[model samples]
Target: MNNTLKVSKYLFRDFKNALLIFYGIILAIAVLMAALFLNVISQESGNASFGGFGFSAFIFLFVSGLNCFKANFKFLQANNISRKRFYYANIITLLSISAFMALIDASMTKVLKLIMPYEDIVEQLYKNDLFFSSFIWSFALFTLAASAGWCITMLYYKCDKLMKTIISFAPVLLVILLVMLNNVTEGALGISIIKSLTVVLGFTNNNPYTAALSFLVATAGVLGLCYLLIRRIAIKD
Candidate 1:
């Protein structure tokens, strides 16, 4: 628990300045965009919905991945911290920050309702349950994304140049294969894989709860891989 506290404190201090600047820049841009959108479009008949989880997920992914690179990893290694502790601490930070962002995003609906008069996209889904369920849903998604991002960076960090190069092209290769397969054969292979995964993960189209559960498992797997990578990671790695 002390290690957890230490890691959290370290993260707070480590990224405080950058985080503030990033948030300020995002807020300023958002305000400008909202103002422009409001001025240009009539609110009464506006199909435009403002205030939903937009940049939070991507920001978490980017920030966490960036922070978990050589510098932080080396620092933790120098401190003689166990990989397990380090990983859990980062997980705590991930959940905490993600939840905070989710709360703010959810509150934006109320704030935007005063300015723009249309049913917000996120708010519509949580009409029956409101803040609690919505926050859980959003938090799960952002955490999963962040964990996946961290896992990817870890993969890169632990890899040699050749491996990194191969990994870099992996996404493009996957996409190309998908495209080629589609062209060559009218394939439900991808869809079948997805369906199989959903079944394995207990995800159901009608049940957001099940989807959230699926994401929880996915997040755990990603973060677990990240942890395993760090277990034997060297200082520079």
Candidate 2:
């Protein structure tokens, strides 16, 4: 088999085994949440609501992608694949999963709309001015999370257990620090800094192209750092 085909097959097999299991659990939780929220909406507004459940499901799938990446990385290494091929395969697999999950989310929203008598909730979701923006943000967040997982896996591959534990928690700590700063500054400093930086970079108008370019640059920089670290520090057993 050719290298691409080999990687593709390996990617598919691992994804089938791991992603499916995680997806099934997520689907079940989503359905249950939808059912429960439907009752609450019906009681409060005399109409069923599926929005909460749908949103929860979406969040679950986004979070689950990290676990999928971790599982796939271990499987690829066990199967004797090179780290480069493993990384490429992981990126491909993650994109495919994200696309599929997005489609599923859309489909569920449609189905919920059909079953529920409440047009108000559905209309709010479909017609909100920030709907598209929120969708794009969700996609960006997923990419960030997946990339973070890959980076953590690399750290684990390169470092001792103690080092891996510290490295793994670094992102969490950074997030906490950001939240604390935001709270302390009453959210002004962070927002001002981001806006100022965006304006300086000529991205203040929120052009989709510019935002996408920024995202690509940031993702590339992260992946590059991961590559360098893994190349230099990874233990080849």
Candidate 3:
């Protein structure tokens, strides 16, 4: 447990500069977009909506997750840190980071909305959710994105060239297979999948809490797969 704490501390320390850099870029983008929107608002009559800012946060964390494992894993292994400790540290670090970012983003969104007609995709979809629920939803989404990236990275790390190729094409193959299945079932499969997603995502009921729960569940499933792949992964130079 002490080793895990040390490792988690190291991970958090290592992420500090990267996090600053990431938010710096986001700040610049937000400034530019706000300026552009302000100019447009000057010429317009009513409220103008700005979106896609929240998505940048997700992309940053997802890409961070994709790159987080290899170098750190190599360094920790060289220093005799066990894989279990490393993984635990990552879980701790990711959860903390996700929560922190989510809080920042939720606050930013509230501030932006107050200053301008800013609405994130979630706000547009969920429509009038409470601040706490929005924060939870954002946290769940950020964690899910990071976990997915980690899972994909671990899979690529564990696979050989041929398996990597297959994995690379797996999404396309899955889409093709889904299309065939849908056609065979005369769109019933697609409809059923969409309906299921709508229910699980709370679109039918317009509940962010349900969607947050689904995202958390999906994140857990992805992380579980990541652990399975990471446990016996062969280190590559």
Q: Write the per-residue lDDT of candidate 1 for residues 134-184, one digit (tens) a residue.
A: 566667777887788778888888899999999999999999998788667
**Displacement of the residue 158 alpha carbon in candidate 3, Å:** 1.0
In candidate 2, how many Å is residue 206 off?
9.4
Over 4 Å off, model 1: 33-40, 43-47, 51-53, 118-129, 183-185, 190-206
Q: State the lDDT of candidate 3 residue by residue for 54-145, as single tens digits.
A: 68879978997898888888989899898888888899988999999888888888877766687876788888546787789889999998
Reference-based TM-score of each model: 0.80, 0.63, 0.94
lDDT of every predicted structure (CA atoms): 0.68, 0.57, 0.86
Q: Candidates 1 and 3: which is better by TM-score?
A: 3
Residue runs of model 3 more than 4 Å from their true location after superposition: none
Error of 1 at 89 (Å): 1.3
Where model 2 places Cα greater than 4 Å from the true spot, the runs are: 26-44, 47-80, 117-139, 165-188, 193-217, 232-237
Model with the higher TM-score, candidate 2 or 3? 3
| Candidate 3 Cα deviation (angstroms), residue 121 | 2.3
What is the RMSD of candidate 1? 3.4
lDDT of 3: 0.86
